[model samples]
Target: MNDECDFCRIVAGEKSAHVLYEDERTVAVLDQHPAVTGHSLVVPRSHEEEVLTIDEATTTAVFETLRCVADALETALDPDGFSVFHTSGPLVGTVEHAHVHLVPRFADDDVTLSLSRDRLDPDDAAELTARVRDAL
Candidate 1:
């Protein structure tokens, strides 16, 4: 286990977390500094720096656990919506582990969508859909 990584420490049972869900492949814990109430982190059991490093089985397990946590969050908090994001760039200060942020948003919440003038056109949207579909 990686001693310096917080998530790794949590998985090793060396640290405490408000864990809502846990399986052989993943663990879901409530965020200490949550943007909104019920915010949580879905993390893989295996330590990996980025999503690209996680194998297919571990990736699938992460999302499966995420879906379960999202459902429970919706039922418990009844948030307006939710956002699932993974930090990709070095500037984001992500830990050397593959994890997903499951943040619940309320109707009057402070969260804002960052959009730009260079938005996708209709053709681009169709192509994007096709590309994403092809991946599945």
Candidate 2:
């Protein structure tokens, strides 16, 4: 664990977080600055800077924790739906630790998650897909 990282502190029992769940590999916590009520974060115990850098086992555990948190939010809050996703880099990854957000959504809430952008042309889409598959 990186001693300088906040999430590392949280995982190491050196910090305070409203922990929701914890297994050997992952921990779920309430977001200190929530976008909506019941918003939670699924974090890997190991301090990987990004989701893709974590091992498969940790990744699986993180996502499994996400699912579990979603279910709990649904059961506890009975929201209209959910907004579950992960973010990295400086733009949205303020925490620096790789984690997934499980947000309980209500129909009346103003929280917006939408993407509107120009669609790729068919040829461009096909080329990108081919390149991605080749890279994989």
Candidate 3:
């Protein structure tokens, strides 16, 4: 466990969090500062600063836990929809440990999670897609 990481401390039981589920690979917990009423966080037990650095097995476990958490939130909160996302980098990560956020969304919640409407040139889009596919 990473002593300097808050999430690692939570996983190690050194800090307190409203943990919903915990297994060998991941832990699902309630977000202390929720975006909506049912916001929760799914964190991998092994410390990693970002998704790109986490191994594939742990990533899969985290996502599976995310699905379970989302389903539970839907049943409990009855939100119109929900958002599942992860933040990376120093500017947006807030916490250094990699974690997925499951935020319940209502129709009138006034929260916006839309992509920019700006259109990219077709060639640029195709090139970008090809680059991503090649990288994969």
Error of 1 at 108 (Å): 0.8
Question: Deviation in angstroms for 52 in model 3?
Answer: 2.4
lDDT tens digits by residue: candidate 3, 40-124 = 9999999888877799999999999998888888889899988888888977757888999888999888677788788789999
Per-residue C-alpha lDDT of model 2 across residues 67-134, encoded as one tens digit per residue: 88888888899999999888878987567889888889898988988889897799999999999999
Top model by TM-score, which number? 2
Query: In candidate 3, which residue pairs get closer than 3 Å at backbone N, Cα or C atoms, i.e. clash?
Result: none
lDDT of 1 by residue, 22-113 (tens): 99999999987888888899988888888767899999999999999999999999888898888876898657777899999888988765
Give the per-residue Cα lDDT of candidate 3 at 9: 93
Model 3, which residues run further than 4 Å from truth?
none
- The residue-level lDDT of candidate 3 at 67 comes to 89
lDDT of each: 0.88, 0.89, 0.89
How accurate locally is residue 33 in candidate 3, as Cα lDDT from 0 to 100? 86
Alpha-carbon lDDT of model 2? 0.89
Instruction: Provide the lowest-lDDT 10-residue window in model 1.
Output: 111-120
- How many steric clashes does model 1 contain? 0
